[model samples]
Target chain A: MRLAKVQKESYDEKEVLLHLKEIEENIDFKVIHKIYYPYFHFEFNVLTKGLMKKKITSGCVIDGVNGRGALIDCEPGFNQTPIEADQTIMEELTYGNAGEEAKQFMYRSASIKLKSMSVPVLALKKKTFFYRPFYVVDDGDKRSNHLLTIDSITGNFHPI
Target chain B: MKLDGVIFLVYLLVLLGIGLWFSRNASKSSEHYLLGNRSIGPAVTAMTMQSSSMSGYMFMGGPALAFQQGWYALWYALGDAGGAIINLSVLGKRMRRMSEALSALSPIEYLEKRYESPAVRVIGSVISIIFILAYVFAQFIASGKALTALTGWPYEAALLVGVGVIITYTVAGGYLAVVYTDFIQGIIMVLGVTGIAIMAFSHISLGEVNAQLASIDPTYLSIWGKDLAYYGQWGVVIGAILIYSVGYMGLPHIVVRHMSMKSTKTVKGAIMWAATWNQLFIFIPYLLGLAGIVLLPNLADPEMIIPELAYQFFPGIFAAILLSAIMAAIMSTSDSLLMQAGTILSRDIYQRFIDKRATERRMVWISRICVFAGGVIGCIVAIYQPPSVFTLVIFSFGVLGNSFLVPYVASVYSTKANNMGAIFAMIGGATTNILWTTLELENPTGLHPFLAGLIISFIGMWIGNYFGRTPSPQIQEAVQNAKTRKKLSNPLEKKISQDMASESKVISDFVRKKMYINEGDV
Candidate 1:
């Protein structure tokens, strides 16, 4: 499958590992496996009505697992990549229904920011499926067998 | 029906109309019916929460307490004045975010999900259903009394009419109906009470009233209450204040307000609205109660002070409208309580245990049925006039506050809180309140039942936590997320990234070791 991935702009593997070690000194980190989390990305041409009509480019990313859509302030670059069958997780939200949901989310954000009853119409400029990278690490604690995920993009930690 | 009765009937009809109008929308989905699709804005959220929390207790029970106890009753009012402010500020934002994250439709369901235990759901549901029903019964009785005073009907007939209207509207309209009507009722309540207070004050200034009260009985003017009944009983005084102040945090019906708010941003505006409305609305009833002692010195039932004061101060049509305010207070509270009880029954109990696969339509029907049954039962019990509205309200409110306050607060604030801790806290607090009230331990211990129960509940949480295991990492992360108000800065994010490097390095070493082993074998 042709899977699209967000360009890794932050850190390489060795650098990421070095940073992770300084944060969590207690746990004996075992193995790290990379997994792809699905998100539907959309770019929109938002028209604002004021003294002058202005067109602004905005983007949104909707979580494929929970169907939660969020407006992204800056557009992130993406590239097409071959999906590794073992590393890719399936998305629960279908691409067919995500467009309308994404549009509604973007519209709300634009209207709120513009504070206008005459909210600019949002035209979809581009839409695509993108996979975000996350590193899942096992804490080799025999007693608890804990697992934690680090967002390769943002470096946020979520213990599961 | 009299003019007042007719006005009240029209009001009831209007409420029923609103409920039926929303019924179509409410039936479309269980979420709509139970939580109004979380679309309620700040103003409506604040009003509904305040009106529901105040209950008929404001019009009847509160004034009655003041009439009997004198200025000491103002202690309750003092706490109540800040009750919504405290509740909204402390729990509003975090609870809203947490409930959404957990996808919990009911407060009881939220507790279970937070604790990750079915047992928590069962215990929480049972406690909420029982106490919320008890709270509803108090409203039913107050409604009957207020209606009887207004229309000159027999208590039985008034009980049937008043409770009947409340149940009808609640069952038909669901949460949206309950909340919007509460918003309207909230307005009527402030207007009615304020009008009466103005007229009463105009008739007798506070100084003159105090002079007369002192002349009648010196104890009537005392802060310690009439005859110093609660003199030097700071524990009792503190309990009186805490019951309405912090007490609101524990009530499932009240806390559900947080869950159904439009968003976390709703909290700031809601706190402002609630604070303003509460300052206008809460202290007046107690002051009127104090005024009642001087104005209506020969009153038969102390609870009838507000209604009698309205009739004495205003003419027929105006007084009747004021009477409508009294009924509004009762009905506003009754409907919310009924809606909450029904939600608990249908969502927390039936859907969770009896039939997990029940469709949205069936669940709505079940909720309606539960509400109707609760109203009918409440009416039947209210007809017997089981106890004074003040007594019933305080008892139930005290128990509920004591039971759930610790657990609810812990859920958002403490990551170590587990299923056993919640269960113990709930049981300990409720049992303490019941025992303290039933055994009448306040006199002997010099402590209010509510205060005693709260102490025990907190201790129980601490002890039970020692025995309970730490919550799952996912739940801990959720608690952390709930507490976070702003995104991590680049520097902080980088620091976190650095902290997690050890795990990454270990994983990298393991993978490299496996590759080297494979190469050697080849």
Candidate 2:
């Protein structure tokens, strides 16, 4: 996607590249085939791509805190949605980041494992399933929306 | 060890022994760690659900409220039963499925994954720690007070003995022991509370007391308080009830009950059973409260209601037995909190932070240690204690309700909220509650700080997203899943084969049943 400002574009491209290299080192894989920062609002493209890198983000949220993914909304920068705040949440969902366990859980393969892996969860508009339990209350588009945390994996956001 | 408290002491020992028996398996895996391998039966599940929710507040404080408030106490029962209804109808099946499907063994784990926010997870973990302590401490203090009141035992001694039993059993047996013991406690509560209420009424000419109360003030028997507002319009009563209904859906400890069930179908019969018992049991306190308003019209402290009744009507041994029921309520609540808090710390936060790769095996041991540690901390907090057990329970509920309302509701309904909304709601709610309660803010209509906090929290969440762009595609998919057509409300019976078929066959049959297909014979 076209981003703003030449310097901004170069900085973002470089940033994504660095993040991609780091992730490859950590989990030994390539994930973010593409990146979109039209708004450059949600700066954690790396994290968003981390989800896409694994197949977990492509899924839907269970009936958990307003399926917009637990913490990070699909909205990049502004809060047009009901979500109140944004924080980086990182969780280690699999034993091996890129191994069969990770692949199976990510792909929703192996029915038994999937059954053990899925839950009454919530996903974001981006189709990222927040695999945890929580609640949400929307008053309306204008006054309703809250992404209250429950529990998910560790890598979704770091403890700040 | 003295004559009067010996039975209770021995009873505690037997309870501890049972807990020890369960501990062997409890120390096996995360499934066994928090959920008892999802093998709990319906009856036990039902009772555990009830007793754990009722807490010590139901025993000592519930009766106290009933004694003073007359029919007003019914609102409490109404809210509670309504809350249970909400739990069964809205959350029971979904939660069970989520837990089993994700193998996301506990409440916080689900939160951690769902939000994909360690910030949210840690916040939740911390809340579980803070709020749960208030809850657990309330129970410990109540139990201590009850035991001491029943026998002239030292309060500290009573506290230790009572809490000791719970810690031992909970640590040893895991979820199963808690459920089975709660089953016992729930039965004891029904029989004891009902029998005692009846006996209390029977001892005095209840009609005479009613007549006396009417002579003094006709409004005493009125279900609504004597005021300008309608019964449902009042801030304290209706607000509390309203809060409770929503609160029940969000409480980590309460919802986790479904996670321990073997099947979602248990929710069906369990609901029917729970509702009947809840209605009847909740009514007992309301009635007793009404009785107290009549019999002891100018009582000084509300907490004295049960003790006065016990001392007034029954023999010492029977009074002791009556107090035992009260103790049971307190213990059940505290034990559940201890278990929940222990799970949060051990599995959700500690393991995640200290040992990234902590195994199911280590988690089991940590969970046991967590239970004991959590219980001890709560007991310490009880030293400064709420005036009564009920207040303490409500205090924690208010905290949880204020902090959890937005996220709880959002988890089920909205797809726009994200981690920001979740954390913001919690922080906003908690901050407002603390400010209001601490400052003793007297709003014109008497809205508790908790109510205000809840409102503010949702507003914060909504406002944050109001300025954001559309959710990413991944988030949209996650939201789509929330709309997964749910099945029967029964936690145990859902998704099972009617003819006792294999698990796969059960699914086909279950799917057909969900589809409203009647063409199949076993």
User: How would the docking of model 1 be graded?
Assistant: incorrect
Top lDDT hit: 1
Lowest summed lDDT window (length 10), candidate 2 chain B:
B256-265
Which segments of model 1 are wrong by more than 4 Å? A1-64, A67-90, A93-160, B14-49, B87-106, B174-182, B253-274, B412-415, B473-522
Estimate every model's Cα lDDT from 0 to 1.
0.71, 0.51
TM-score of model 1 (CA atoms):
0.68
Please give the lDDT score at residue A65 for candidate 1: 66
Model 2 lDDT per residue over B402-440, tens place: 777677566546767677777888888878877777686
> Per-residue lDDT of A22-42 in model 1, one digit per residue for the tens?
666555565467766677887
Segments in model 2 whose C-alpha atoms lie over 4 Å from true places? A1-160, B14-41, B90-105, B154-157, B160-180, B203-211, B217-219, B222-233, B253-271, B296-301, B311-314, B359-380, B442-445, B467-470, B484-522
* Model 1: per-residue Cα lDDT at residue B290: 88
Candidate 1: give its CA RMSD in angstroms: 11.6
Clash count, one per candidate: 12, 124
